[model samples]
Target: MTGRTADPGLIGLLGFVIATLTAQLEHLGVQNESPVFWIGAVFGGVVQVTAGMLAYFQGDDFHFLVYNAFGWYWICMPGFLLGGELGFFEVAGPARGVFSLMFAILALGFAFPASMHNSVLPVTLLCVSGGLGLQAAGAFTGVELLGTVGAVLLLAASALAAYLLAEKFVWRTMRRRVVPLGRPWIAGDPDRES
Candidate 1:
């Protein structure tokens, strides 16, 4: 049997949306903190990292990096916070801002390359960057409004990621594009049909 593996993007995006939405909800006070960290560590961290490895095996360099990097982000954030609160070490408020800003930069780094692929991913990355930026701002200023808006942005990113997952996997069995994922922002033929 010489068949290929299923698309890792499906699981990756599934995990992405799950973690993003859950975290956003928790941030917005719609959920409790207890489940959020565990979800982030398991689905967002471990699962995404595993998916990224699968993507690498499939020769998808971009998705591979996206999944693993964000996966580690999910893992480390909770780990650091928990470690700090558990007396393992101290966590400074300023360090949170710097940490978030760093990831925001990293998310922005993928914007252009993602733009070359499809409209959704670049926009998704932009929302992720915006969310992280706002989160950083909130962390620095201690203003809840910034974080609230950031969580909203993350929710939007989650929705977009879900749509992308459907376009890639769910309706993929169809001959035509059942769930459209708009044109690439920077493709060779923007007007050309796929």
Candidate 2:
């Protein structure tokens, strides 16, 4: 099960792009909410997890951690929504604010490590962090504008992720480096400055 395969990062990034765009569009009121659940559950959750597993076996620990964490995040979202909808547990605005803030912090933490890979990864992670922060602010302050801004940021992040996927998978398959992600900031070791 481990001969070789297309870079798992491509699959994970594609899944993230599709799911994030769908959820953000719903938040922006451009689409119905129903589709978001399925997209998050299947594409974001399952597909990303699969990619993470592949990365793990391929010895790409960074991608494995990033993809797995985000995949689980997406997978658990439906459960949280269901809990609120079914009245299993009350999720007040402040609670949701706290949750979003925590996730934002987590994304920021990952961004530092992601920066070692390439410019695009760090930028993508920063967008995700910023979007989550906006969402938190919106929930906490009851401001619709903040949420709208967050959705816009998420949409932008999704576009970036899609481009990365295309660059990594499609162009590479064609034997060209069409979209360069830029040089890694950390050079040899991800933990040490170069």
Candidate 3:
């Protein structure tokens, strides 16, 4: 426990950002219908899911573990985006909604587990997943207002994390005086003890 363990929070943060983006894209009417969005979703999903699996094995109550597990949304979202972006899959809107719905389910399901271990990591991830779900619903349903909220959540989570990390590790120089010993405490030899 004293040694360093991989930060699962990164995966959580990834899921958060992606989820937020998913919501934002939905509002923008560019979610599954856009190739760029799909690319981002797929790439992000693979990273998150893989990280989550690793965390599961570590079995530490690190917050990152929860985030990674909930990241499966990455895989689902990209499928919708790809369908819309590629034109071969014409059910982009419905697909996005489906994935977004799935995100909500997964996010909620993992919430308690994360909270039971690490509060901040799980809370942030929850916010992100919720945002994604809202955005996806709005975008697919043509609700622009919900998209804006999603964007805000995304920005907020990122800003908060950055601030937390910066605050957590403050660099300071400590001045110390070096004391030199000219000779050993038991100077001449063992016979001196007598």
Candidate 4:
């Protein structure tokens, strides 16, 4: 099927990974400090790289595809690379916090785009937003406050898309309503007959 089709299972799986990682990262130990960071980095990096590559092959307008593919490659891949760097280890917390904002912008910017083409982008945006918001709250406020908000937003978007898809495919209901463009008319009134 085309990428445009609904993929609820995939969305659910990704959401699960995102939510679990977000939860695990909250209780940081020496061994497990930033587990969500690593998971997110890998998941995000691989996805961007893969999707970007696919976009390249699409051979549509080079500008948009190149922008999308390269943007992902630069943002997602580098977060992982920079996090793994030696200098980054010294200030891992601050570093991840700062760099996470960049990811937030990218994810949010693409959210509308994703919602337009596929259900994946919308969910991914919610996951990334939630995960990053958690990191940010933890960074600035010493509390993990945004996870619930993120999860809800992601879940809501998913439910909405699912509802739309169900209404479209299963129920086979009308997707739109168009009112006629004309003046109102009165029935059985002789003056309004014309």
lDDT (10s digit) by residue, model 2, range 113-190: 877877887888889999999999999999999989988988888998988887777554675677877777666554
Preferred candidate (TM-score higher): 1 or 3: 1
With a 3 Å backbone cut-off (N, CA, C), the pairs that clash in candidate 3 are: 8-64, 9-64, 23-135, 26-139, 32-81
- Backbone clash tally for model 1? 0
Report the error of model 2 at residue 32, Å. Answer: 1.9
Predictions ranked by TM-score, top down? 1, 2, 3, 4
Checking candidate 2 for backbone clashes, the offending pairs are none
When summed lDDT is taken over every stretch of 10 residues in candidate 3, the lowest stretch is 171-180
Positional deviation of residue 101's Cα in model 1 after best superposition, in angstroms: 0.8
Q: Count the clashes in each prediction.
A: 0, 0, 5, 0
Residue 25 Cα positional deviation in candidate 2, in Å, after optimal superposition: 0.3
Tell me the deviation in Å of residue 85 in model 4.
Answer: 10
The worst-scoring run of ten residues by lDDT in candidate 1 lies at 185-194
User: RMSD in angstroms, candidate 4?
Assistant: 12.0
Q: Candidate 1, which segments miss by more than 4 Å at Cα?
A: 188-194
Q: What local distance difference test score does each model get? A: 0.84, 0.83, 0.52, 0.43
TM-score of each: 0.91, 0.90, 0.59, 0.45
Q: Write the per-residue lDDT of candidate 4 for residues 121-142, one digit (tens) a residue.
A: 3564666566556665566555
Distance (Å) between predicted and true CA of 136, model 4?
1.3
lDDT of 1 by residue, 1-194 (tens): 24745777788888899988888998899987677778898889988999999989977788899999999998986786587768786665878889889988989998878887778888999999999999999999999899899999989999999888877774545535777777788864452221
For candidate 3, lDDT tens digit of each residue in 57-79? Answer: 66644434444544555555556
